[model samples]
Target: MFGGGGGGGRKPLDYEELNENVKKVQYAVRGELYLRASELQKEGKKIIFTNVGNPHALGQKPLTFPRQVVALCQAPFLLDDPNVGLIFPADAIARAKHYLAMAPGGLGAYSDSRGIPGIRKEVAEFIERRDGYPSDPELIYLTDGASKGVMQMLNTIIRNERDGILVPVPQYPLYSAAISLFGGSLVPYYLEEEANWGLDFVNLRQTVASARSKGITVRAMVIINPGNPTGQCLSEGNIKELLKFCFHENLVLLADEVYQQNIYQDERPFISARKVLFDMGPPMSREVQLVSFHTVSKGYWGECGQRGGYFEMTNLPPKTVDEIYKVASIALSPNVPGQIFMGLMVNPPKPGDISYLKFSAESKSILESLRRRARLMTDGFNSCRNVVCNFTEGAMYSFPQIRLPPKAIDAAKRAGKAADVFYCLKLLEATGISTVPGSGFGQKEGVFHLRTTILPAEEDMPAIMTSFKKFNDTFMDQYDGYSRIIQYYITPSVKT
Candidate 1:
């Protein structure tokens, strides 16, 4: 006897075909790092997180005015309460009204596709003062953070299969991920590691030419000043030459200046590409289109959770500017609180303001501490026998070139792994220090390196370094076979 429903007519759903685009992308490193960290936690190990540049996780605190503004913005009704006003700084209240007035739709309503005009104007002023050039407010588009601005810029230019973007081989993975996710070709250029991780113009020319020859329309070149994972800040001459190259090649310039405030060396002050472009005078034509990005996530703020940032597109055609706005419009607007935070960030307390003295002192103290941390970490790394670290001239990372023993290299090969990655994994296992391998950021074919944040608390750094050195020596001794192979690989490649 057949049941009431004799047969089922429905077919199984194929979830595989639902997201073919997502399937094409792989963020394996991040996933693996997370999984490994979780496993170690379960084992009751103390894990040192250095894989990402997050300061708050490392004990760096935020400043006053910004947080106060955040509290007000989060609870707007506070604006009406006299008690609330007393609790809040007068400057904070004034700033809120200024933001509301400048807000495209008065903070209560939706803003323009670009952003609130007043904030943009403040951003413009900030740019002018920082870059030493005149900036147009209309060209600025505030976003959730530099990441959104970057993705939008990438989306705007990456039209079809033929379009491509030139990015440094050892780059912030965001560029590679965005280009791939958007279905655009990625043209890789090598950074000269031997010469302090400098940009190689020859490699840039060769990469662009190769892409163009292959029918790929090279659209833009990305320059991460105070580079991520590498920590090399470009010189003024380098910036000028790069700008010239961009103009000659007819490519849009994408300057990731998020770490603009993190420079440690006096020689390498964060030089604005806007300044370089404008300073070139009439021959430079001011016609070269450029997009400069900034974020509150870096510098002294460390408000990564807030995700407040903006990007300015200078010297672009009016039509292109509108197109960018249209794209941003689709996302409605960045978080409202984030927008207010960004406004305060760019136009922070000035002298004579009630909170100026306290705010300025607190901000400077935070920066001073970071400076100390950077120096301490760099000095400690350099003291190790087998690790060679570049100066932490700018940015908060120290990318050290580690000399692995022959045994370790052989063990890694036997286990079928990149030597640096193998070393990092073992380091993580032995001690809870988490770091990203150079391979993840694209190193030279044979050289092995690792990127670690110099952000652990100052007092704990010495102990961390000691633990790292001990682990390296033990790992090398344990893997003698791998060390031999690594030596052979390096011998021929070694210069001098």
Candidate 2:
């Protein structure tokens, strides 16, 4: 009854014709608001992209030593130039020569699918140093960025539609998007907002049981340490508990530790899950499979454009690792420059090296500025009428919870938008500050929040805070009696 080209006209591919799993995905970091921001910018509007953790776009400078080394590597002939010493440090020149020797056919050529062997060795050393445990260069699959490695791992893990990955509520949407794209069900476990977005095992257990009841086979769990969006650093005790839970449940652990170097608090230090698991020793370490991801895009490096990152696999079967390698080979190799950056990231200028002083200064300045901006933004959000923000102890974002009035909720419902989306859009219109809605990252049914990067330059924070407060105050005032109710609910009256 159906004709190829005779039924009026052939439809190219509507929503119904596309892959259902692909259609289910949504990435709000560069979603509608960002597009609109771009348009406004073209029309002469000054837009600050707060939706994503892109430090260089916000004026954070890249470090000198890494750039110099990469530059020389890209063009080795520069080393032969008489003025090379004036432009690059002696150590940087030596480093470039060292890496160039490691490269198979220079920067223009494709590398081994697993990555340049020498770089992988450096990554292993970096990990060994960080975790105080041995790491295998063989297990490292260098990709375009941490994202590629994450997607590959998920693709390898997800069997079918019934397979699921336990993702954190208010998680980075990459996990959800990757799960959807790979045809895996996302089982969300809500992080405790009252306890500064800490992981609650009770909630986790409930989520797993619920998914199981619904006939969903949870294969793995994704934990974002020094979390994305919510920005909570998991404690060592919590990490141990998570490992135990995964071990007992026969689940793999996917640790998104890209923000490992972004910790701002003295009290909460970043601990690799590998370190914790190995510390547990014996059967626990042997039994649990972990894939931890890291990137140069976040932290002080902020080399997002370079797209350099790596993921290390621990306790995965050799066959499975081989399969991952096969999948990686399908793409030939990740960009050689990115691979080079990954190598340089793990092994930067050391003590007494020619570039060490400048490297240290550049790195420190960027990190300290981020800390200051985070505190300023957190304070600004807390000062708002119906807003409550947890401290950004780690990571580059502040996920602030906003209490919207019934009227605003109804308006959002009418407009067919999430409550936080409505608020964020209005904020964008009033002031050119673009942020992602909490619903973009999963959240509870009635809760409303927004994720804004604490990444605007330190000097610009005061102006951003002023504009942010002004907009929120005016917006809250429009919705009558909302602030009073939130204040009452949050701080219950003491009846003497």
Clashes of each: 15, 0
* Candidate that would win on lDDT: 2
Report the lDDT of model 2 for residue 342: 91
Please write out the lDDT profile of model 2 over residues 165-225, one tens digit for every residue.
9998888999999999998899999888877788889889988999999999999999999
User: How accurate locally, in lDDT, is each candidate?
Assistant: 0.80, 0.89
Over all chains combined, what TM-score does candidate 1 have?
0.91
Error of 2 at 461 (Å): 0.5
- lDDT (0-100) at residue 143 of candidate 1? 87
Worst 10 residues of 2 by lDDT: 487-496
Candidate 1's residue-wise lDDT over 195-249, tens digit each?
7778778878988988999999999999999888788899999999999999999
